[model samples]
Target: MSRSRPGNGHRGLDRVVSRRRLLTGGAAATAALAVSGGVLGADLLSGASRPASRRLVESQPAAETAAPRQRTVPTPAPTSAPTPDPRYPDGPFVPGPDTRLWGVFEPGAPSNIAALAGVERAVGNPQAIHWYQSWSGPGSELDPVRLNNVREYGALPMISWEPAHAGWGTDQPPYALARLAAGDHDDYARSWARGIRDHGGPVVIRFAHEMNHGHFAWAAGVNGNTPEQYVAAWRHVRQIFLDEGAQNASFSWSPNIAYDGTTPFDQLYPGDEHVDWIGLSGFNGGSDLPWGGWLEFGPMFLPSYEVLVGYGKPMMITEVACTENGGDKAAWIRRAFTDALPNVMPRFQVVCWFNENVLVDWRVQSSPSSADAFVETAGTWRQRTP
Candidate 1:
């Protein structure tokens, strides 16, 4: 049965909408994960609906309009202020230099805990487990069981919380950035804020990430969204979380690599006070698609890194992956983990891998050589502490 809208007490009906895999093969059908009050977390993992398949989308570099800014480096920690959370002594979810961390995004996670076994087998347990949730009703419902499962697994939970429903690209209606800013979704927002606040554990909420890119509804210049609306919507939702006392939930305002045709990061940023971490979604398509060519990890992310670093906050690579079609994936992984992350981008406290076979096989284990490269680098990482 269809349910009432938020504020009417009944959450919307749990239903799957029709859509295809984005960015590849025209469009393939996929189901969003469904949650209900009666289901156990394990059952949700194993029995809940899963996407039938996924596609690959590469970050194509374009002619940047403006000159690149000078890159910024990490500075000394602040001397005194609010008592820091032990999990993130420096800032909200910010790992210290001695505690560099990496995370993974398997297609099946939060629900299907076993889906991470392959990753664990290759590189040991990740410091964080990444997942997604849409603003749609059932499949996107915030459940404590899901959060606890990740915590119990000895990893922090990072949620890519999109404001639009699954498969709904740039034209989400009630979820328009302005509508959100105007407080049309307060009931739903309040519910999630309270849920995470009450759970009382460290959680990373990457809200409407890659807003500088046009793939999603929240992105400016698409779906009638303006940069102002985007910032307003972000600040509005963040304030609601604060009002609910959701101190444990930290907001990561992520944007795409400021490639050609992407919006400027400055225009879209909600400001330092509104954001906890500066995040970026970058990938090396590596000749996987018709328009893609192999680009090294350094060049692929350096432009955006320089821009985001100036924000003076801890940074994270919210989404990153490389396809093995054209260049050496193993070599890329070794350089990224060993040289680039440790030496070049010391301000980046966390790196999350997009480990799925979506458009092209992006899994680190796509080849034996690539898997081994990751294992070697991963072992050297100093896992973050509480």
Candidate 2:
């Protein structure tokens, strides 16, 4: 499943609309507001107004004349007051200095560790392998073969746990968050947790990823799900794993970078006790469709990064990729490692590229240039300690 812009709920629309209205109304309206002398006047005519005025001038039509740029006066810093820190201080997962690389290959049989090894040979060795499994069936059967295969390849296993039986974009999810929180799925959760415990190695479980988006059934306000219910369900699952002696298994609380307007991201958080790592899913659609554009990696992740880092948890770009369409795919890949990974996202401890060909060609080898970029970037990061 992919994190997309289709169901984003117009989050950036309000800001865009407000700015457009301010600019299109012309400087005469700005002057009128300044002369009005109230909250609007105080705000617009303040020292902070230089940037806003510059943007307004730039937004004017070609035929219309714009006001000259005004001098920018530096604003004094605000007084620092002693306030209680609101962060959840105890983040469970704390990775070492080196960021782990990971990926998901083709689905079904081709997605096994052996196939992933082939990808590693082509690109470079990733420290982890990301795969998905569903809870549609009742059996507690675990895939020891695949898990062992991953370990043998010197990589860890990262599982995207889907509670619902349906595929992505399904309107109604059969498994509701209320049901899960109420212990309807406790037996299944325990069975799965025990299966992992019996396997006896470190594993990362990313349950109901992208929950902030409306596309998932477990998402808030979907199929009778709410943010509170999502939190409840997450806590219930984590407790079950703990009770089942799944100490080797760590929990990842993941949400899509963009969320539906109705539910804030903080409301969906399951708190520090239940969460080990903070996972985020983001993608650059890269002009494959009308809604998709060739977005850089930094901008796509910054919004979520700014919020999640406050929790002081180890961060992971659990799912990320840009399409090899409309723009320079090689440059995007190059910048992701050389710029975004090392500089823009210093808090991220792991990054898993979504290498599937679904929706758009997200494979690292979509072109030779892209593949080369991956190899080169992976080489640079591999020298660090994990």
Candidate 3:
């Protein structure tokens, strides 16, 4: 998802006023602290206690010097076994025997099912193929041709259902969460659900993904969309799918890695009953833009992973990539597969790369080294088999 300057253009008059008050007051400070604790709790948990030397220094008076110079004593390592990774208390959520690989191919190019074949050719065969479609557009309807194509390739189809017109970067989006919650778009949602039911195969539906980002009109705090309205809208759509007997439709609730502290993601959650998978969008921009920096996978995602693991739902990195700029993209990709995914984030059931060249050169083949790194790293990880 694209980033934009924060605004309340889609908010109600009352909401805008309240938000302004919060921004100007102590409530904002409190919320910021709470967000910090939630996201960075894992790292904080380990180093929560101050060092003994610091504690001793603070306890001593400033006027009085220490009677004797305290000798530095090295602490011995623990003889006990190391604690297990808390991210998976009940063991990792392995859908099959291995992690699922998926992607959105050439997002800036034309929306064509045929383009996916090229993506598979570039990267190896993915366990799932992700594609996007707006509620109303040239490719609005759930195309059977696309679904079948993905199925024939022995991969599940993951659809990102944009609840607006196909026009990107438009100031005014056609659909709003408030209207959707009011049952205005029930027919459209139902029709799409019915199409999936008729397809007679499993489909992962990621609706209004990255809703925490203000760039999207459907995002909460935008377009008159409060957190409650977003949940209502989500349940409304999910219930319609259930009514249409789209039992094969697996719902994923995705939020961008909460780098922007505006939206509280916990409030936007529609509950475990409404969602099957918890999805996150974690990308490394690699110093291309002002917000961009050479961030490793752990720092970029570990905090968000800490928060999402508490949901107790299977997690998927629905969108992730590192730009080939100002750093070794190959090494970054290698670390993602070897260190982050397999070790730090073993609980994540699937990890999908955002294979697009939209904002930065995010494509795996942006450089020959990056391509080789991806292919080599991916080969070491076990992929889901159909």
Candidate 4:
């Protein structure tokens, strides 16, 4: 989905093409080499890399440092492994063999159930409900009400947790990646960790998503942030959650599909030890915007997918949609769920549809044909339950 910047007339993937060059041919190959820290690259990874001596806090046997924020009663460990639910033998939120989970993100969903239900009726029951949360905002306190609503509706709560200001602008100094790693936001991070621990259920925290895209403050080289700082910030935050015993919250590291100029995966990834799932966000803007190129689902994501799948972690297309300008949107939807999602990319366990009107009419209900196409193949995708 295009991350719509409200005040500025800019939206992700829809930004002016000249500024964010979408390279091809030899240029695309060079960029791919740069992503892997090839000789052509300036030492972007040098000095910024995580020290070889620092161990993940969870890997240690016990808490090795004092709590940086207020503490709560420690979360108790489970006495026994859960008797796996029939619908989800692997575990809650874990997709079954040959099964792919479907998720949706309506504009007012998880709070406005009536609006969310409208989408659910058009598509089948979604296995996950995707939404956003900012570190500093009026509605940011890990609201139990919102979480409960999604839980009651029988869908997993997938929160795209941004560390920036609530407005999600491109430059926010207070929420800088450096400050986050320096223990500046421990109080806030810890509170949410404790809240999830108390909630006693599964929640997917998509922290600092699409870090390769320069649309947000958290992206590398934006707002004075660097890939090294991003890695540190992620590991630091995940460590705090572990210290608080927030085992129920799973962390997903998402990046925008690797456009030519975006930051590389190796530079931003915290490591396999720090992440539970790998996620990629991509949108086909078609010919509706300046940078929108008409590419099929496979081409739009294949560059990044080739790299992320190598990480050997469960993968998800956290945000995806198509615009109706240059192609048959209905056929795209049909081909995606029917063939591309299942056959072309089997490692991707979750596919979340961006059902909003941002930039262009990206919603499946944008047209009768588009809506019908999605409904026809919706039931074929599989999901899990607690």
Candidate 5:
């Protein structure tokens, strides 16, 4: 929640850290966290989240000649069978850590990555602070030398919002989804939803995120526009920033990673009563399964987000990645936050890491032995359980 880049005195602080990365293959079609105190009973729902079975977990694979982005989708049941009734939400899930894990860069590279040691031999996980480079300029618009090459090579500028049929990168058909479901939002969805409706701050407009397992093009999603019409187009872009009075911003529905037991998180629900949090899009790549360290693989997707646990809201991973560029994949980043981040940090609240580090020629750069195991898994992943 910081700001001040207007003309460049450069104070900066509109912190909406829950990131939403990916554009080519719109990132492995799905995702995969959260926290809070009190209100936890029910003798801990069979030891907190466990229903979706047969866990496999891997990302960015399936190439032979269909490499525009792949992982086709198949890895559900880490736990989710819900239906014993009694309107759910019990005990023992203890949860903590409301999402924000960082990474994703390419704002017109120049490398001095804040000072550059050969930009860590070419992007060896430089702790990123958002750099997917959308729209480019105006208002929340940033580029001060790519925000000083993301805080001089360590990592901070977050941006990713598109969904008037995704436009800027192209997707809005059906007569621009019938003029944004009859409300008529244009100008590229009013320049990323009118800079958070007018300017309340903390921007992270994650729209049409993983649309229930399709490759890209915002799924053409329908139920007669009844995923509540994508939660009423995110409550009409959160009521056009509360009727143009404008106030920063916050809205993420992101999907993917449902480990198919015949697919049904309510056909990718955008209605947990109009979401405010719950984002899961994972990545581990390098195969051979098992990557427990990034919070011990967060119990492989906590039984498929127990069907959005009665909408108590607050969960993130908005977007994530590993590589098609291959091997040693930064030694699976400290067992994924020291052992799958305590089984998805009790339904995560903030965990964003799409750190850019390509190999091929998406602009020439190569450094994978998984970047010295992602700097030793970001120094013991926030010292275990806090």
Candidate 6:
């Protein structure tokens, strides 16, 4: 998503993609467009591309060139933007933990993928790689063999999902995703089915995550949906997908972890039957935070993760980022992911990072060199490549 500046909210996926995660609602998977303003009021949280950095976005225009150079000095930590434009004005969306210094908005080419391998080596594991997006049809597909190859590297396809970009979740907020949730709902689900079938495996599907908050129209609170109404809506959408038979998919009930206040994970819920997993997303900023506050400070993001223990199902940091800019930037990231170790392990299934530049660039703390280490330790990580 390209930066939209102040008053340019009329665009859609066709124009540019602005991937954003809020301090409260958080962001989305590869190439996802996040809406801030308490969900429906998305305009408050994110928009299209604002600008780019020389080293991160500009250096690796394609995935092949992915890799960041470590600085002798920390380089004052980057001043990250929540949403930065895609390098190619018009290209497919691809996200991954490769050579791109700042974020995945930049496509990962062969070189970029190679850089990711280096990171995997550093982390000491390379079983599977996220393979980026799981929703988009063709290029988004991942075959069994490809899956195996990714795993050979140690990471797995920690695929992610969104309600569908048809209406409200587009470039601007307060639009109409109602139609997407209702009429086109099954169609939306079916598309995913085809992709998974094509990929040939059981996949992870996080549906209308953070529904309690209001950025996208698919959720209950947004688009004028009441809790009960939204529940019904979710049931409808989920049922349609089940009917379409995306059997290879597992459902995850993800929500923004909470930054400003403790997000009432249970209240915004659509109920047990409608969900099989739980997750959190939050980036309430702190100077003490990493990645320019796109990621929250302290173990600020941890409480929400701890609360999911009662859910019984596996948990995931569906989207995570930190903005702290002191100490070893890469080491800080390693600590962020590693420290969360199993506070979260039993309840955990996967963890992914939002690659879009937050109020600034995507990679605030991670250098291509640093990323190599992080990628190795994680079971699965995803990226969006265009």
> How high is the CA lDDT of each candidate model?
0.65, 0.59, 0.60, 0.66, 0.39, 0.40
Per-residue alpha-carbon lDDT of model 1 for 144-214, expressed as tens digits?
77777775565667887878766555688778999999999889999999988776556789888777657
Q: Report RMSD (Å) for each prediction in the order shown.
A: 14.4, 20.0, 19.0, 12.1, 20.5, 17.9
Better of 2 and 5 by lDDT: 2
Worst 10 residues of 2 by lDDT: 26-35
Off by over 4 Å in 4: 1-92, 383-386
- What TM-score does candidate 6 get on C-alpha atoms? 0.55
Clash pairs, candidate 4, are none
Instruction: Report the number of the highest-lDDT candidate.
Output: 4
Q: Estimate each model's TM-score.
A: 0.76, 0.72, 0.72, 0.77, 0.29, 0.55
The positional error of residue 20 in candidate 5, measured at the CA in angstroms, is 24
**Candidate topping TM-score:** 4
- CA shift at 304, candidate 5, in angstroms? 16
Worst 10 residues of 4 by lDDT: 32-41
lDDT of 6 at 90: 17
Clashes of each: 5, 0, 2, 0, 77, 83
What is the TM-score (0 to 1) of candidate 5?
A: 0.29
Model 3, span 1-386: residue lDDT tens: 53111210011222212211111100000001000001111211122243211110011111233486565996667879566432211111124333345445344222354565555566655555676666765657767877777645545467777787654433343477878888888888888888887765557788887777575668887776788888899889988987887766777888777664557777888876777777777667666644446778877777777777775566777777777887899999888877787778776766777675555677787888887888787655544231
Single out the weakest 10-residue window by summed lDDT for candidate 5.
52-61
Pick out the ten consecutive residues of candidate 1 with the lowest summed lDDT: 27-36
